[model samples]
Target: MGVKNRIFKYYFPQKAVDLKQKRRGNCNGIVLMYHEVLEDSIDIPAWTIVKRSNFEWQMKYLRNNFDVVTMDEATKRVCGLSEGQRPFAVVTFDDGYKGNFNNVLPVMNKLSLPFVVYVATKAVSDSSIYWYDKIIGLLDKRDDLFISIEGDDIPIRKSHSNSKRWSLMQKALSKLKSMSASERDIEVKKILDENDARSFSSRIGMLSASDLGAMSKHQLVTIGNHTHGHELLDQISGLEIYNTINKANCLIESWTGIKPKHFAYPNGNYSENVLDALSAFGFSTLVTTKPGIWDGSRSLMEIPRLGIGRFETKSQFKARLAGFL
Candidate 1:
């Protein structure tokens, strides 16, 4: 660990955390956001992939330290319809990664913990990979020194470590996220095909319909909609946002036999129209990528969540839950 982490791990005592929690009382709870959970041996070092061991530690910590609840129960707590222990924690996974089914479900099930998995429907049904993953794969496997997208040629660096490659991918994703979904797909496909990057299998691809079905059946798992195309609702037209969400809900209901009552904004982007569309669709709560505790002061439609994954150390995780980071 680095110097900062050393302090958080060895020096940041529990008494300090207790004081912080006590000072920040009456907050509704905290909702944690995660993406992929993989074994520690996995070579992919993306920010979204939390190693299985680390994930287990975090989940166990939540189970012991906080009242871990499902999305529905969290909503009830948000609305004062039900009561629960203070500093509630809600675990959620986004992008419907197969890791969630293969890795996360077993851990949560073993601990008898509840969580929400938001499925981006098209990826699940079409058996296709997420655009961001494709970008990472293409960049990591590229043989050329540089690649050209549209008319712009971006330099590719020879990296001694995964960190350098990840840096390149982050820059690429920043540009991609600004574009429309179709435009982003076109760019992603160009890079993947030109470099002959293979699509990922069940190891990293989105969950299959059967996977969602099986997971939803677990009493501790709650299936939620994450839009059909995983498009950024704030960037798209109102009609497109409505259609994507509506279509996703139908497909998810078909697979899980349960109509999803909650929705997570893809890329954590939303607008007034997006919120209105979700309300019209009868979604109970909407989760965003905004970081902070859900203190019941925010609208149910604008619920904030702290994104957690590989980048966070155990001490940092403790501090995050305690609202220190």
Candidate 2:
């Protein structure tokens, strides 16, 4: 192992994290972000897809080291209304992937841990695949395809390896992320049409309405709204933002028999208008992809979360949670 890995393995970072929290009066909490948890590796080129074993290990470590609290409790801890261990932690998953219900639930239930899973309501209602997954799936299947962006043809070579595919996908996603919702959708559709590709199942599909309903009934699971179409709120108009969130809120309420109180910005993209739109819709809490310790210093409407990626080592996981990375 490298020097940093060795230090993290020994948990030397925890002391620094603890001291930092201590210096801040021990009021900070950590909210972890995740997307999917697969039963095993299928060599997906995404960082958000954690394997079952790694997820379980991370959960167990959280259970033993930090006070794993609910979103409500974590909010309270942030506001100094509740007391717990220093550096409280909340687990959350975005995109409402089927793996969150299939692979994540059992382990979380076994550990008696509380977590939140945010859903893109339209994807669930229509049983559609996410745009990111669609891209990865299509690219992984062929070596001859090339994607045209901004009058440039980007080649997609399989090379019979994941590294090349991963690099290209990252480039594509970065470009897509910069585009408006309509533009991104049009580009994604074009890629799909040209390739004559359909998103094949490798356990990365969206959760169905039934799955969400069942998960909502569980004690450890709290379902949150991602949006109607999972559009980037910052790039859209305020009216569009309100409509999307409102639509998702109504759908989620219909499915779960309870209105979702929490919302997560799609792709962590948000602006002042986005914040205002969510406020108008009456969401009690909001989460973003921005990484930091959740102390009372920040607004509940723009809470920060540390995402746990798939390829992270145990030591890296520990160091990250301990606030050293």
Candidate 3:
């Protein structure tokens, strides 16, 4: 622990941390959303990939400190049915990353933790790269990146600080988010061509259908459809949105032989139309990127989740679960 952290813990005891038990039987639950879980690597962006060791530590923390519940149980508790004899939390992974099988599964199995993995079927079936990963690949090819985003030349300085790298990556993501689907693809392609990024295929670090099949068969795992192409509902037409959801759900059902009853909005992007589509499709439980403690109002559908990303410190993780952040 850092000296500052030590001093803070010494002086300001997290009295509320102990109150978790008091809040258990009647309190709201939380759903944690994770993405890729991989070993120490610098080539990938930190936002999408949680280091394997850090993930293990976090799981250990959850195992020792929190009541790690499943989505079904969490939904019931959120709907005013009491918590399952302890303060409840549900673990979920977004996107179908291969490292999930390689790194996260073993840890979760060892810990005997139940979790839900949300898959955007296209990423798995087509063996295609998610756009965000492409961006990271483009950035990794060079230390000093000078990109032209919407006519502005944004110079990503060569810095040793991860914060600086993250800032630049966030800027790139923002620029990409502003573009239409076609435009985004064009821009990513341009970057790839310019960088001569040959090895940046979608299959580099993502799960295959067989991997998903194996995971689905795990007693502690549940598959949630995250839509094909991982499209943002708010950005696409209603028809496109419906087709995406239908296509993804159908593919997942075909793969797992069980229709998915749960869904998570890609990138937490949604709208009234998006909610309607989810409703039309009959997702028994829906989750979003919104950060909050789940209660009666968030059950079955439109549930909010907390993103346990690399930026979060140990204390911040606890604080977030405890509703202190």
Better structure of 2 and 3 per TM-score: 3
lDDT of candidate 1 over 189-222, digit per residue (tens): 7876666665433246779999998988899999
lDDT of residue 108 for candidate 3: 92
TM-score of each predicted structure versus truth: 0.90, 0.89, 0.90
Ranking by lDDT: 2, 1, 3
Top candidate (lDDT)? 2
Which regions of candidate 1 fall more than 4 Å away from where they truly are?
1-11, 139-160, 199-203
Sort by TM-score, top down from the best:
3, 1, 2
Please report, in order, the local distance difference test score of every candidate based on alpha carbons: 0.80, 0.82, 0.77
Tens digits of per-residue lDDT for model 3 on 297-316?
Answer: 65456788888876556676
Q: Assess candidate 2 and give its TM-score to the true structure.
A: 0.89
Worst 10 residues of 1 by lDDT: 138-147
Weakest 10 consecutive residues, lDDT, candidate 2?
195-204
The residue-level lDDT of candidate 2 at 285 comes to 88
